[model samples]
Every structure is written in structure tokens, then in C-alpha cells.
Target: MSAPGAGPALVLASSSPRRRELLARIDVAPARVASPDIDETPLPGELPRDYALRLAEQKARAIVRGEGELVLAGDTCVAPGRRILQQASDADMNRRFLELLSGRRHRVYSAVSLIDADGVQRSKCSENIVKFKPLHADEIAAYVASGEGLGKAGGYAIQGRAEALILWMSGSHSAIMGLPLYETRLLLKQAGYPIG
Candidate 1:
């Protein structure tokens, strides 16, 4: 058996730099980052809440977790009502996403999953509501032109310049940025991972 303070090394099942940076805020660095390749297509009629959690779990389990390694994964999505807004793949898509979100309240669901060395899977979800101030054409154009929203869920990075456009927000800002530090800490504690 390992020493009382010893624990399995952490493996992050994602390639997202935001997630890595977020982990750094809590001073918990993963021993390795394993990018999981999985189909992220949502099931027909799936709700946004379920979609985020499912993706997180799947991403976590997709990694070939080696012995003595605990895998952590997370997924974030934007949804207005039941419609899940996918990550913008291009400038046009990004502009459209921003246009849709303008002056509207939307939900950002961030879900986290952890698989411990003992193979116990634990998960949590953080749902945040955010409303953006009405965006002008030039503002949206400039934002889209900046290319920060491309490839990001909700077509905006809460931690970036997009923050200036936010009129109201409730819930964990860390979650909206990508990972929920509070929930992540809880999962780490539950897994007996040392956290300072």
C-alpha cells in the first residue's frame, strides 16, 4: 500500500488549455494530459444539463486510465432553453452565436467527472446564467474578428474580452470560463487527493 499521503497521479482527459489554467488556480496540476477522442454529438432530444454531464463522463472514461492514475474531465456548453449552442467553428458561426446571445439570458452548463484509482466515478455540474448587454454590429464584428470565440462553446470566452460585454452573471465564474474550481475541489477531496 502507498503512504497515507500518497495518492494516484492525476490525469486530465482533455486538451483544453483553459482547463489546465483553471486547475493551476487551485494549485492542482495533473501529472499528464490525455486528450480523449470521442464523438461529442448530442443525442436526439437530449437536454442541455444531461448533455454536459454525459460528455464529461464519457471524456473521463475514454482515457485508458492506467493503474494508480485518477482521470479528470470536464465539458462546458451553452444553451438557451433546450437548444444547445455548439462551439463556433468559423467567423460566421461566431458572429451568429453572438447575435443570438445578444441581450438574452443563456445558461452555461459546466460538468466535471473524476474516476478514482478504485474506479469510483464521481461527477458534478455547475449551471450559470449569463446575460449580455445588447451588442452592436461593430461590437460583434470586432469580437468575431478577434477570433477568441472560435472553437469555444457559447462562442465566447468569459475570461477574455467577452467579459466586458456581460451585463449580468450568476453562478461560478470559473465554471463559465471552463472548469468549476469549487466543484473540482470537492471531487478531488472526495477522491482523497491532497488539495491545499
Candidate 2:
């Protein structure tokens, strides 16, 4: 799918600027960014890791792959036990998410899927543990009012002010932010997408 040392053109199956920014940090750029439309509703009793992987693969497959083009997709979610915390759709839901996450450890699962030019799909998932400091009612209220939590998984953005609330974290910060760079780089390199 490539001539000499060159790699196949990459099609990022996501519109997330964050993901694109993360890729830029590694000096990898997608030839195109495709927005994938998929129903993100989790199936009943589906585990968090499985749910994330499924969404990533589904998103990659949803995009039409051109000749010699590779499609990459990602999914990230916060899971408290078996529950998947979705992006909060409203202010109240955001507040509730913060309340539930307060003073506790939760799992952030980031999954990535890459489809090579040969149509082989490779995927990986990263699980990170994060603990937030005990949040006061006023704190939650202030955060909710700031409106940064809305539309973010677990009702918070790790790269934003929410990082201040985190007391500790384990695993990849990039994973919590939405893409696992280490795992992603390995997949891309394995699929012959040139990277150092």
C-alpha cells in the first residue's frame, strides 16, 4: 500500500480536535478527518471496556475507506464500576456526574481502532484509574455553573479545571483525555504508518 519508505494515507474517523492535537504531538497527521455517525447507546449489561472498543471499531468501519487509506477511530468513557458515564447532556446531569465522581476512584477506558489498507482492523484499549478530591456542594455548583463539564465524559475535562479536582491518577493521561498515544503509536507503526 506504500511506495518505498512512505506509508498509506490516514483518514481519521473523528471530528475531535483534541484527538487531532494529540496526534500532532507525535508528529503524525491524518490526510483527512471524517466524522463518523454511530449510535453510542451501550447495550444492556455491556462492560465498559467492551463498550468502548465496540464504539471505536464501529466508528472506524462507518467511514468509507479509500484505496490505500487507513482509518483510525477512538472512544473514551468514564466507568464507575460497571457503569459507563457518558458525556453529560445537560447541566443537572453534569452536576450529578460530579457528585457521583467525588471522593472516589473511577476507571477511564480509552479505546482505539485502526483499519489498515489491507482491511485488517487492529484495536487496543487503555484503562486508567482516577480519584477526585472530596468535592463540596459549592464546588460542584461552581463547576456546573462554569459549564465545562457538560458534554464531557464523567462530566469533566481532565485537561481543564477539572484536573485541579483530581487527587491522583494512574495510567495514561492521554488516554483519559480521549486517545492513548502509546497504544495508538504502536498500532499505527504496526500497520506501517510511518512514525518514529
Give me the candidate number with maximum lDDT.
2
lDDT tens readout by residue for model 1, 1-196:
1233367789999999999999988888888899999999999999999999999999999999888789999999999889998799999999999999999999999999999989999999999999999999999999999999998998999999999999999999999998999999999988988886
* Model 1, CA-based lDDT: 0.93
Instruction: Give per-residue lDDT, candidate 1, residue 24.
Output: 86
All candidates' TM-scores? Answer: 0.96, 0.96
RMSD of each: 2.5, 2.4
Q: Candidate 1 at residue 134, lDDT?
A: 96
Stretches > 4 Å off in candidate 2 = 1-5
> How far does residue 16 in candidate 1 sit from its true spot (Å)?
0.5
